[model samples]
Target chain A: MTPRVRVPETGYNFAYLDEATKRMIRRALLKAVAIPGYQVPFAAREMPMPYGWGTGGVQVTAAILGRNDVLKVIDQGSDDTTNAVSIRAFFARTAGVAVTTRTRDATVIQTRHRIPEAPLAEGQVLVYQVPIPEPLRFLEPRETETRQLHALAEYGPMHVKLYEDIARHGHIATTYAYPVEVAGRYVMDPSPTPKFDNPKMDDCPALQLFGAGREKRIYAVPPYTRVRSLDFEDHPFRVQHFDRPCALCGAGDVYLDEVLTDDAGGRMFVCSDTDHCEARREAGHRGEGA
Target chain B: MALARGFADPVHDAQGAFRAMLDALARPGLVQALPAALAPPAPLTSELAAIALALADADAPVWLDGPLAEAPEVEEFLRFHTGARLVADPAEAAFALVADPEACPDFSAFAQGSPAYPDRSTTLVLAVRHLAAGEGLAFEGPGIRGRVRLGVAPLPAGFAARWSANHALFPRGIDLLLAAPGRVAGLPRTARLLEA
Candidate 1:
């Protein structure tokens, strides 16, 4: 006899959102996929948490997640962080779905500020919590001007802004949330993730979705899509690097976060990806502490 | 009218169908198998019905063509399960269900959305005789790795030309979902049909 599965007794609906709202989001998501990197307006729903606390990612995850889906939540690349734990627990209680910290095992991963160190597969989806969906917001304060710019394919102003960066600083000064051109068309902001993860957005096997709750917008980059980071021939786009390996897992290639152990100048660099670090440690990889 | 048979478990079944549709859309020209549920009247395949159930709601107006539009069973099923309102005009439809690809209306008849809000365009769900890979139009776009081929049978004479015209619209054209028997494939406006 097969073992019976336990049913969730949570009062909330499946995934904690109504089917109507899910259908609405799913419709927007389909449009987002169709137009690759073009932001689609959605009926942004209010969540228990505030706007900046990943309400957008939560809504997107709720719409796409199934009962069998393995969910993974991350904040600043760590699964153990407060935001990650809170969102993961919210889904676990409402959806009664299995949650995994392993990037390889997760079918749906909701992230804020980082992509996983491990490469995502074809079937997996990465939901990004975007605070601002528009790359031109800072340049043009008015939505009317930006919409006209996109319609006319007038991206000269964007290039001018980047050129100004070179004029002011010796190199392109912008470090995180680098803008990218998608499918040779729309220019998209890949959330606030450090520029290190921008390359991972290009021609990736997994689908990437961005949702902004406050902005009431949703966008997507389908699998195998061309995403080129904005740069000039003289000053090419580059990622941040570290002179030393991770202090916890000894990962040299992955993105690292500098952690100050004490008030003194005693600081250690560690892998920002908690799952990657834990996996490395389990595999007998040790760092300065060990 | 007989009570139309719907998914036994609404949440799980709809989620399953939605995921398949999502995969199909994300990876254009890839044929994804859908659940064979609710065998509707003439012209409407099980795959199309499943998609309609998953994506359609009362908020979305649907446009239907061919014999399937006249079939009461199809109407009843959509009304009961999806609560989608049927519209006579294709342009006004949020989703258009085409029974026969050969007799389907011109691509321009449906909503291509606006310059400001391109996502408001209509999604055309065309019921094809077969959705497979082999000799047909080659596809290269966002979802495609190098190139993927999709062979859609019984298409109208001017489909390729119309598709090119539609694609030229860019960021503003109807997205397509092709269904055959138990499998479905996507052809978003971004997908370009290369010369065979």
Candidate 2:
């Protein structure tokens, strides 16, 4: 195990970004929390990293980060992924805060494309990196019209899109970045998280924040807020199903990733949440692969 | 009057206060404790002072009501600490400090924001006598799991009716932070105040 890093007295401001920037982001965050699911426009600062690489999530995390917070970063549910490791190390050097891989130990989790499998408690915060904050941007393609649609609660077009999917694909084919109605008011884009994670957001105890760097938008779903996925009466919303348990952890009803082993197409389905799998393995849960 | 000291450690302390405020707002009806060391002027509790120090800045204008507005020390303390622009009109404020909740302005008096941008509305930081857990008013909405009971003393008159109207605005309405001596509770526009 690595030694815990201490917060340095010199170098950058507490969290790398200056106090003014943090204040700006903090004000925006307050507004975001006030109106759940409503996209609040903010002045996105240019971080050290490039766009499309979790800058928005980094900003949000930096704004809320404190010396005592146990920070965790995950990319596609894996703590060792390049994105996650870089962010974790970035904060470690910049803020000098303690970093953890355990889901339960973390007070703030900055995630890209997945929520941790463990249930978050009341005080924990989940920040998501959003590439596109607007759920209707691709459909309407007009910022003015989309804002108007959100104002009027005009989500019929979203249902129609789902209906069209059912007509062609025999099911609602929105696999990722699935749209959800927050508090029955605003139609929000829940980042690129798989539809399987949608249900986990409803009535969740943890505060959920979404930030889109390139889009310059920030939104939130407060703890215990009702987050309902868009669906039809005949074609109800459903998550992707797996026929087998995780090859490594023997965990069922969890999102899995398929890894090819042999040249002739031999593959094994494993849990996408790496920490969850490793924890289960440590707890003596064995599977065929183990 | 001498200017009171702000957060001992500006960055970390503000971060802690912001987290407390965030948690309070995220979990409506749940009381979160603020940094207690802050000693602002009378009528301005430490919780509200910490919130103003953490969230209110030059970009965000603040409005005070009743005793808070009358007390020059309170205004000076806020301006000296947070550097927030104090405004006269409540509608123009991004944050409103209500020292006297009983005589505070109605929800409609503050900025309700427009249909296009509801987040632009004002957030009220009301100083209440106390916050307790009891068979008080029932609240159900976002941030609330099923239902939660909150007891706020000396609320504005016709609070239920005013809250109902504020809630009816849906995406456009004011949010509130009830500040007690050491704790604060949030009442976002999404939370509905059930009548007795």
Candidate 3:
């Protein structure tokens, strides 16, 4: 047999979650898929690691990863980012799965902040880290009350909050982490990505899963889940940007991460989604000292 | 140095830990072993840490008091693994883990539920040597539907009276887990304790 070939005890598919855990997770996954955007409360387990720092994604990957899956983990949309690298290293040791940097090459991608620039294909999974699963949580303090609000489909407070923002700041000053109503089902927190990424959530083909370790909540968006940004009709929803091309890739269509290089306030904006930008660069691309 | 990228997770990933915890809580005064165990402190066994770790994360602000309060190892362990926030006051905490309940902060100091919504109450993790099992507290209430005797080791000073006050608060009071080395007995705020 080849060096990589293994037996049952040592061969735990990609991630090391047991079959029972995978079965339980699979049941939850079905519900999430059926519900679209509702935050389904789950019993998040303790990994070798603690909560917060990717327990949610870890569990998801553990349950979903099969023997031949290629796993890619990214933080802030970059594979090189510290947290992303750490998670990658963790899976390499525990799950023994092949890791990839290119978005298209991997079957599953776990991401924080920026989403992939390249459109994800069907069958590819995208997981997100959710700080707070309840979009109405900031407005409502109690879980029971929030559950009632969801049951009633009462979203007056969210509209009021967005309207108030528009009333105060010109053009909806909220940058990232904008809220979206999924498929008219449940209002979901699209992780903490700047509102700029909000537009990317609409009508996606790949599966989107969100996990909140601390809050004990998890939710999902199946392919084609209609994600409407929570905004007033008068003000409408807005994406944040300078309307400029990427400094590094000279790509005008991509989301840029505005970076401050010095104390004198010289600013440079690079593509926030590195995978897309790098792919573009590899195809014989150049930019303005970007 | 562990990096924390709370990337997206499947819906069920978060549910596994929660279901186990809820099961543990529902069975009040029963022990539940966690899927993932960890190195814990003297008072905190692997089981306690596992429960705490599963429930407590960065989103869930945690408060510690008494012996385990602010211990660097514990704090570091939580931060590294879960990215759970450590709060100074008991009132802000979602889960309050105490080494010794007797020397712990006042139960009233913690966040109790308001009349409008009683589930806003905090869940307390009280570590004791042994729970006086099978005989002390005459547990009565919604889940129990009748009286069941529960024995606990000597509680912290005035614990019974304080818990009585907690019970008096009903859904407004804090939930509790009287934990020991490897086992724990859960008591949600809804449970009422009568003399066995």
Candidate 4:
């Protein structure tokens, strides 16, 4: 059997970053909380792990972890996914913190793709792993230009790009990880979550943190923050999703990950967050758990 | 090769070089050489090599410009020792390394900090000739207690003007580091050059 745990015996923590690194990340986290939605550049250390693999989220979690905080990790909104399992196990060994799949119970939920269906409370912190932190990076090839645009609050080019896409494709082809304006100051990427989850961000009671390790940025949107998606009056915003309800939970409102069930294009929909689904199941709600 | 006692490899030097980089920025023009030992080919200073070894890692994504290929030994050493991703375009790099700032890439093409989170900027590490107490412009900002001066080359054509645009973004903009044989200096986005 492949050993699920892989932390070394000594020298560095299970992740290999030293206490100083965690302290630096901690300092950045404090600043992130203080500024609210401002992305803080940190001297990100290289983990034994690869990039795009929760390095940023791990750094944030490692920095803020104390003796009491409960930690949870999810990928594609499921805690049992291979990547989620790996990261959760990492924190368990290094920080020795309790790990739970239940969203309601976790103090720190390090996630990729989707946020929990259960409401995040004020005391809780949600950390997201970001592949690319910049929304304007694609539109403006130069960081120098994008900075100027953001400084000037000039998002004309972004609106143009989205409008052009709609004109050509009849719909904005963006499936997940759509961008949004945060707390009226920064245009932020809500990780890769489908737009179905975008509405959940407004005035949220819980603090949301975004980390892009490869990009070396740590930004946050505090609890009860304001977020708006950039859209023209002629082309209003619409969330993306399949027309079907969750096949397992039978819930019509949840964000559904289209699951292929048969060869003839027959498929099933399920709650992306497994913990919430499991909780619902125990509470006498079951769609068709396969 | 004698394996580094604690770290996986000696080239994992970025682990230590980061603190020095931090100090250089936190202190402003305060010169301190790198700790790791490295050798570079002609036109590349050992100081510059150390900075690269200290900053670049396997997971660093792209944005390679300047004399990396010009010095084949340095290139091979980096690839062999550090599994760093080679980004062909300067526009793509997380850390942009230059042996000589005189021929550095345009600062505009790199990642500047975004408005809401001006810290998402890219860091440019250039290998320069000597670092002295005189030269360049005076500086003051978040970290410095008062004003300080340092010696260095003038910005390339369109450099300072574009940088002014970057600076205007405040919390966003590129951070620069100038390294010599054993010393380094930082120019964080929060810092500004006071014209004499």
Rank by lDDT, highest first.
1, 2, 4, 3
User: In candidate 2, what are the lDDT values of residues B1-196, reduced to their tens digit?
Assistant: 5689998988888888888788777888888887567988988888788888888888999999878888889999999988999999999999998888999888999999999999889999988887975558899888888888889987988899999999999789999888888788888888888878
- lDDT for residue A104 in candidate 2, whole number 0-100: 93
Off by over 4 Å in 4: A1-11, A14-16, A262-266, A288-290, B1-196
**What's the residue-level lDDT of A102 in candidate 4?**
82
Give lDDT tens digits, candidate 3, residues A213-256: 67766677755556888876777787764667887788887778
lDDT of 1 by residue, A174-209 (tens): 888788999999999899999999999999999999
**For residues A168-235, could you state the per-residue lDDT of candidate 2 as single tens digits?**
98998999999999987788999999999999999899999988888999899998888999887888
lDDT against the true structure, each candidate: 0.89, 0.89, 0.67, 0.68
Task: Give candidate 2's error at residue B11 in angstroms.
Answer: 1.1
Clashing residue pairs in candidate 1, if any? none
At residue B123, candidate 1 shows an lDDT of 95
Model 2 achieves a DockQ score of 0.78
Model 3 has how many clashing residue pairs?
29
Please give the lDDT score at residue A74 for candidate 2: 93
User: Judged by DockQ, which candidate is best?
Assistant: 1
- Lowest lDDT sum, 10 consecutive residues, model 2 chain A, at A1-10
Residue-wise lDDT of candidate 3 within B1-196, one digit each (tens)? Answer: 4432221332233334443444344445445443433455444555456545555665567887766664676776666655679888888887788777778777898888564334445678776666654577676543332445566664668767787888776436777776665556667654556753
